[model samples]
Target: MNQGLIPSRYAKALFEYASEHDCDKLVFERMQALSEAFASEPSLVKAVRNPYVSRRDKIQLLTTASGSTEGDSAMTRFMELLADNNRLDMARDIALAYLKIYRREHNICLVTVTSAAPMAEAEEKRLKQLIQRHLGSATMEYNHLINPDLIGGFQVSIDNEKLDASVANELKQLRLKLLN
Candidate 1:
């Protein structure tokens, strides 16, 4: 009954349905775009969540906004599902859950690296290679971030696993050691 659980459940059902219909990839991509649009457009979110708006009007607006997109059916079904469950407000959560399912099914991992300074191309390449070697797949996506508070060195995270080698982390460890 948790709010987040509802979206994930709906997303899982939709994923299975899409897979059965052989439109999983297309629907997943469309859902991702729709979710991003919904997140970026405050007006769209407001309109969708407005209780006074008729269901038909909401559907028409979504259809018009999506215009000529190839995955209209999947989106339409998803919208209807949300409306029926009175969960239109959680559309973004459903879309994100669907994307997470899609990525897991496709064996994709998102890796993030943060450092005090931007990494050189060669350094990035080396890190990518190392990550790929460790993950045993060349299908990793990397995001880089510069955080000056790190002071030096870098940190890497792949899903829930984290490697922190930042100067700030080292200093904290040293301070703790001395305190103990």
Candidate 2:
């Protein structure tokens, strides 16, 4: 089976379980924290992925690393399933997939706004409103980033859609039009 397929399958199972228990949001948040912890501690990730390490050892390490958060039986069971299926290395992917499912269920959309410079509070608010209007979705989360290379204006991305209105892009378009 494909690597992605495996994680997605596990994620779907966990999502359903969480939904039934009405703990989907909690699980999603916990998984995200775990994923970030693992990413920041590459040594731990490497140890978990090492085939030389026994399953029991890996499980012990995971339990210790998870600390109080492992109190959730669902998460504990999910960890055991990962170890049993030898898919522990895909923990990050599984967490991400779970977050995606959770967001979809809550009708939350993540939007990224990249501008040439830091945006004013008013500008940010206006841009967020514009995005909400365009998406026609009440639940929108905005993440702002600054990229001076853009020269001016901004670019916004919500899911698979992108809206670009940077000065650099406009200049390129003008140059192309002149060439034609």
Candidate 3:
């Protein structure tokens, strides 16, 4: 079985179930938070995948990390289901899958831009326009970051697409050509 299949299936089922309950929005927000939590804390991933952690505790920790309100049936029930299946450890992947599904359904384009330094106002505006054009007719959410490691220029990631225009990338390509 493909490793990605499990999370995508679970995420789809959860999206449909929550939609039926008329709380898909809340579930979506919680899933976003869950994904962020996984990214920001390595320990959270460790705990979820830890053999020593109880299923109940794992669920509790996930709920808390996701900022799920007490008695939120949709979020709670989803965690419970994950626990019952011994799939709690896959929560991070599931959350990200859920976000992707939700964003697709809502026509939201997630744009991430990273540059060697902060982009000037005109550059930021140009990037936004480029993203808008790339994901035509979709709502765009843009995030910009600085990564000196790029050496210069910038990178843009939209959904599964990537545009790497950094100087480091150019140098690497040139080096490969010279080697060949």
The most accurate candidate by lDDT is 3
- Candidate 1 yields a Cα-based lDDT of 0.81
TM-score of 2: 0.82
Candidate 1 residue runs with Cα over 4 Å from true position: 34-71
| 10 residues in a row with least lDDT, candidate 3 | 126-135
Clashes of 1: 0
lDDT of 2: 0.83
Give the root-mean-square deviation of each candidate in angstroms.
3.1, 2.8, 1.7
Q: Who is ahead in TM-score, 1 or 3?
A: 3
State which candidate, 1 or 2, has the greater lDDT: 2
Ranking by TM-score: 3, 2, 1
When summed lDDT is taken over every stretch of 10 residues in candidate 1, the lowest stretch is: 62-71
Residue 58 of model 1, lDDT score: 80
lDDT by candidate, in order shown? 0.81, 0.83, 0.92
Give a tens-digit lDDT track for model 3, residues 1-180: 787999999999999998888888899999999999999999999999899988889999999999998879888988999999989999999999999999999999888999999889997998798789878899997889999999999999987799999999999999999999
lDDT by residue (103-130, candidate 1, tens digit) is 8888878799999999899988998889
TM-score of each predicted structure versus truth: 0.79, 0.82, 0.90
Q: RMSD to the native, candidate 3? A: 1.7
